[model samples]
Every structure is written in C-alpha cells, then in structure tokens.
Target: MKKILFLILCFPWFGMAQGDGLSSTVDSLYREDQFYVGVTYNLLSNQPKSLSQNGFSLGFNLGFIRDMPINKRRNVSIGLGIGYATNSFNQNLLITKDGAGGYTYSILNDSQTFTKNKFSNQVVEVPLEFRWRTSTPTDYAFWRIYTGLRVGYVFHNTVKYSGNQGDIKLINVSDFNKFQYGLTLSVGYNTWNLHLNYNLNALFNDQANIDGIPIDMNTLKLGLMFFIL
Candidate 1:
C-alpha cells in the first residue's frame, strides 16, 4: 500500500525530531554558567593620619563563574571563579626609590606641586559566592543576590610621583603586602547590579611605615557588575 510505505519513510525523520527535543531539554535544566565584568570607584581607608586621597581612583575586573545548583528548582547555587583585576588608588602617600635599593615613604603636603601620585596593583583573584536568584533554567531575565569572599595575590605594583621630585616611577614595591582578601556583595535585577568590596587586610606589610608609624590602609570598591550567559 502507498499509505503504509509513506508512514515507513517518515518514521526516521520523526524519531530524529524527538531526539533533538530531548537533547535541548536536558541542556536547559542544568545551566548557570555566566561571564561577568565590573567597573568600580576604588577608595582607600584606614589611612595614616596625614595621608589623604587627592583624585579619582578606579578599578576593573572580569571573569567566568562555574555555577552548581543545589536545589531542585535550581534557584540556589554556589559559584567559584577566577579573574584578573587592576586596582588604582590616587592618594597623598608618596613612595620614592631610595638609593639603597629600597623604598622610602612620606605623606605629601597639600601645597606640593605634583601632577600625579598613585599606586596600582595587578592581581590574580579568586571568588567564591553563595547565590540566590529568581531565575529558572530557561529564564534569561531575573533578580539575583550573590555574597562572597574574594582573595587575590598582587603580582605586580607601580608607584609614580611627578612634581617637586621630578618624574619618578617605582616598580616592584617590596614592602607591599602581596596577599589581599575582602568581602564582596552583588545584588540587582536582570542586567545591572550594585557591587561592593570591603578589604580586611592592610595594603602593605608591617615594614612599610611613615616616621615609624605603620601604614594600615585598606581598600573599598563600589560599582556596577554585569553578567552574561
């Protein structure tokens, strides 16, 4: 029969369609993978009595998070990420290279004529977060709150001073604390989120001092965070 032959010929296509649908469903049920980027206003805190910030300080970071859902509906999960960040602080704490192959620290006066004085850090960072979201596997737009800890190692540093002292660039600041750790919180809707970081440790080691008083400055960042799948 022609009708029976037609049904037989179509069976393979029908099975193929069903197979594709099943595959898509499985992929949709277990996805929380995202890439994120952020820009921040960096602030220094716990400063020495004479040190003060002068200009704008900035920071940026980007990374990917591996999301693992723990609940059946997939709204709760944990994320671990590795990223890179460059943080800069513009302040009056001045650092100059001493002739003995070390560094000297001082607080600049308000009347000092300097075009720029700042220190920047290049860091390799890791973040671990506990995430709660109003998102389902199939939803693309939702609200989320992620709180976590971020730890980093400062691999490189630079200090620049120009003005009364002329142009001076100092690198490999030996007195800097190479290890940095902080608390992070990010919360918001679909595309825009507010992010904050409060660092718990000093920016420099105990050996970095001003007139025998240790410099115990820390950093706080406030900014926007964006995520993409």
Candidate 2:
C-alpha cells in the first residue's frame, strides 16, 4: 500500500517538472533579439514651389533591435536600436553658398538641368519603439505594430551634379542640418512591414534661403521593412 502511494506522488511531481521545463524552453525561444533591414522612398516636403522633384529618391536602413518585455505574456516589448541610414533627394533646385556666407537655393535653369542632380546625407541613428506582436515560440509568423521616434546626426553630406555645363561634386555641405529627429511607424504581418517616417525638423537651418524665403523643407519617407529574428 505504501508503494502504491509513493508511485502516485512521484508521477505527479514528474509531470509537473516536465511542464516547467517546456514552459522555460518556450519562453527562451520566443524572447530573442530581432534584426531588421529597410528601404524607403524619400520625399521632400515644404519645398519651394519652383523646386520640383524629378524622380523617386531612396533611403536605406539596417539595425539590430533589442526587445524588452514589460508584461507577463511577453507579446509587447520596448525595442531600442542603433542603426545607420542614408537619404538622397533628387530635385530641380541647386544649393550654393551666397556671398554673405549663407546658403541659397536657386531654380535650376535649362543650362543647369543635368542628367543627375542630387543631394544626400548619411547619419547614425537611434530608434526607440513600443512594439506589439501576436508572436509565440512555436509560431514565427505574426502581426506587428511598432511606433517610435528616431534621432540622428548627419555625419556626411554630398551634392552631385552632372550636366553639359560640367560635373560638380561637393562634400560635407555646410548648410545641411547636422541634427535630425523624426517620428516613425511600422505595421504589417509576418516578415514584411509598411514603414513610415516624418522628420520633425527642417532639412536646413535659418541660414538657408530660397528666393529670400527661409528654406524650411522637411523629409517624409514611406517604405517596406523586413524583420529577421
């Protein structure tokens, strides 16, 4: 009779131990770091009326995201990442320095219209997001919505213009904004997400003028993001 009692107690304990181990394994697999790469179509906003966009400009981003769980269920997390991004603008306006040491924008004349006229900048960026997903350890595909802010510093700037008149390449343009901050969002399912960003700051400082109007252009981007775990 004692043996029968011992067997009953031991079986329950063994089952409980197996259940705990399975739970731990699921948690470990579910809560791993996520990495992402994205491509964007950049659009310049608040631009001068005379300055028209020629074609679709591009931006690229890559980063590793650390997810911090705040709830017991672990479906929601705070994501923080450090990333690098580069943005290009293709437009009809030319940026140049005026005699007073301020930057000036002029409408490109026919002679100045070249095969390629673009301004681009590279930045080191930090992103913070409140992330929510319907994800589980056994399921790798899920729906997600992540909204966040990004802060960046422009480390490099370049202007390239090629035409019949000549080819002009300028590095580290003085008028470009050095510090930039923006709002960002991503929403979708599985590995693909629709991403959007709108810069909160002007692309140039007060020292930049377009036809005596202070140039206050901002940047807007729409793109696709791919997440990899």
Candidate 3:
C-alpha cells in the first residue's frame, strides 16, 4: 500500500515540474520601441541666392510611439507618436518691425557686420510611421527601418541680432509659419539608428522677402535616434 501511494505522489510532482518547464521556455508576444529620443544637425534648404547659412543649425527631439503590429509575425507595424522639438537656424537674414505693425526682411551684405543673427522655434509635433523589423518576441536586438511623416505646430519663435544696429530681439515676429510638416526616415540595428528629416514647406510665409525676392527657406535635419521599450 505504501509503495502505491508513493508512486502516485511522485507522478503528480513530475507532471507539475514538466508544466513549469514548458511555461518558462515558451515566449510571450510583446511590444517594442515605445519610446525614443534623438538629436539632429538642422540644415536650411531651398535658400535664396544671396542667403547662406552662417553657423551650424542644431535640434533635439524626444517622443513616444504606440507600437501596433499588423502581421502574425509582429514584424510589420504602425507607429504614432507625439513629441517636442526645438530648433535654431543661424543665417545672415535680418527681420525688423515697421511703424505700421508690419515687418521688414533684409539680407545683410558683406559690408554689414553683425555679431549674432539667428532665429529659433519651439514646436509640438506628431509622427506617423510605417515600421518593419527583424525582431521576434525573444530577441532583444534587431534591425529596423521606419519611414514616416511628421507634422508640427510652432508655439514660440524668436529672432536675435547683435551688430552695427546694436542688440535687437524680437518675439513671435509674425513672419514664421506656425504650421510645419516634414518627411522622416530612420534605419539601423539595435540601439543606434540614423534619422533624416526634410521639411516640405517654407519656414516663413509670403510676407518675408529680400529685395522683392521671396525668402522661401525650408529645413533638412540629419541625426541619430535612440529607441527604448
């Protein structure tokens, strides 16, 4: 009788151990790349003939993305994110206000000397992405390529100038376009990724001009992107 009872208890314990082993090995489905941060070298694009970039334009970006997998393999997905960005562009263009509540736009000639001339904007941005990766539920490192569009609303803008005209600072000077949109691409493996952004619209509105020429300047940014779960 004791031998039969011991066998019955041993069988139950063996079954329990087997169940635990299977549970530990089977991988569960998971989400990846829900948060991200980046830094970029901002470049002025579609510039006028006399206009040239005087200093390096730089920008920082940080955001969160909602990762949604479409395929059964979970390798193809869509991402939507919201983020904040601040950018600065340094150039020779000058902006000043007129007596009639209007604004004046000018490009400094070589004869004109200025210590500082630049403009900056802070924006709230949204990003939509189509993402593809070689990632599985069990893998921690994988290759990914993501392409997307980003739209931004400029909440604050400023222009600063210091030179022969003395120090002049203007706030929300009325020429910058409050709405901005751009195309974005990110590609890499593991934690390091290369990111690119190109703005499709001009940075300023129609009122900004230099000697009857429209200063329809846009921006291009190239940088690195770091993603985290």
Candidate 4:
C-alpha cells in the first residue's frame, strides 16, 4: 500500500518534467482549433463516510474550447466525462468485542473478539463534471487551472462479514443503488488536473445507526490528470 501511494504521488513529477518539451508542440496544434482528451489518476480523499477508501482511482475526460478567449489569454471549455471510484476497508482490523463476546478470531497472530454483526461497505460511483479554464495559450508555457461540479451515482454498495463458527456472509444493501449525486472541484495545468470531490448524500438512506453510532459518509477524492488528445 505504501509503495502504491509513493508511486501515485511521484508519478506526476516524472510526467511534468517530460511534458515541458511536448507542451510547445501541443500549443501549436491547439492554436488552429482542436480538442483535448486526457485521463486523470485520482487519490481518494480520506474523510468520514468517504468513498475514497481504495486510495487510488482513475478517470477519462474529453472537451472542446469555443475559440473564445478568457483574460485575453486563456480559453473557456466544456466537456463530458465518466469516472469509476470505490472505497474499501479491512473489517477484521476495525471490529472488536469485549471478550464476553460472540466470536473469537485470529488476525496476523493477534487474537480478537467480535460481535456477530461485522460488516463494512464500499461504494463504486460515476460522475460527470463541467470544466472551465482560467489560463491563456500564450502567457504560461502550458498550464491552466480549472474548476467544476460533478454528479455521481453509486452503482454498487455492499458489506462482507464472517459470522460465529466461521460462516461467511455478504450482504447487499438494496436501498443503496446506482442513484447518487455529488460535486467536484479541480485545477489542471495544460494536460494535467488535480481534483477534489465530495458526495452530498448520506450513505445510508434509512438513518440506521452503525454499532450504536451513526455512520454518515460523504465521499472525497483527489486525482491527477493527463491529456490524451
């Protein structure tokens, strides 16, 4: 996991350095009226009830500028995109019992007790965001900062657990569906954009308490992008 995160953070610097030369060529091409397409690698935001448990995610986007200029330097753009994201956690590590418990289990040479109702949920979603640029084609070598809002739907939300006597069960919360909505904020340079997103709805519609405590998850995401076109 550490290695995965290390690469996610470092990969951009590597690409940024290499893009310096390519930016010149890209600039010439876009001046004649063209489109841009790219893929973004997003780092899920770590927040309560967030869908970003997976730590790493990717998205694809494409858009066209209207040839109108902004600040006499940058151009305005609108685009459509779809993304897939998920959040997951290890149950055994978070669950616990008071030894006057229902079940006993061993994880990584450690013994722990847990109540029967042990479950965790991960959500997979897709969002569409509207993008606008704030930089010009000539001033900065190749950079633009953009921001927008996105709407997302949760396609899958489920929980997994092992009952007493080692009986495993996976529960599908039917109430949880591909129906979800959210907003996104991002800033990009030329072909790369950094993003942050938050889900506006609660994970559980029933308002049911989790472990005698309420669990309300608002998703968060951090991502990096690269133009593909």
Best by lDDT: 3
Candidate 2 residues 52-141, lDDT tens each? 888879888878788887877688899998999888999887766568865567779766658988999999999999999987775556
Q: On residues 104-150, what C-alpha lDDT tens digit does candidate 4 reach at each position?
A: 22231124333433333333333333445544443333445545555
Model 3 misplaced stretches (Cα beyond 4 Å): 1-27
lDDT of each: 0.83, 0.80, 0.85, 0.43
Backbone clash total for model 3 is 0
- Per-residue lDDT for 138 in model 3? 61
Q: How many clashes in each structure? A: 0, 0, 0, 9
lDDT of 4 at 54: 26
TM-score of each: 0.86, 0.84, 0.87, 0.51
* Model 1, global lDDT: 0.83
- Tell me the lDDT of model 3 at 2: 67
- Candidate 4: list runs displaced more than 4 Å: 1-74, 89-126, 134-143, 162-167, 188-194, 207-216, 222-229
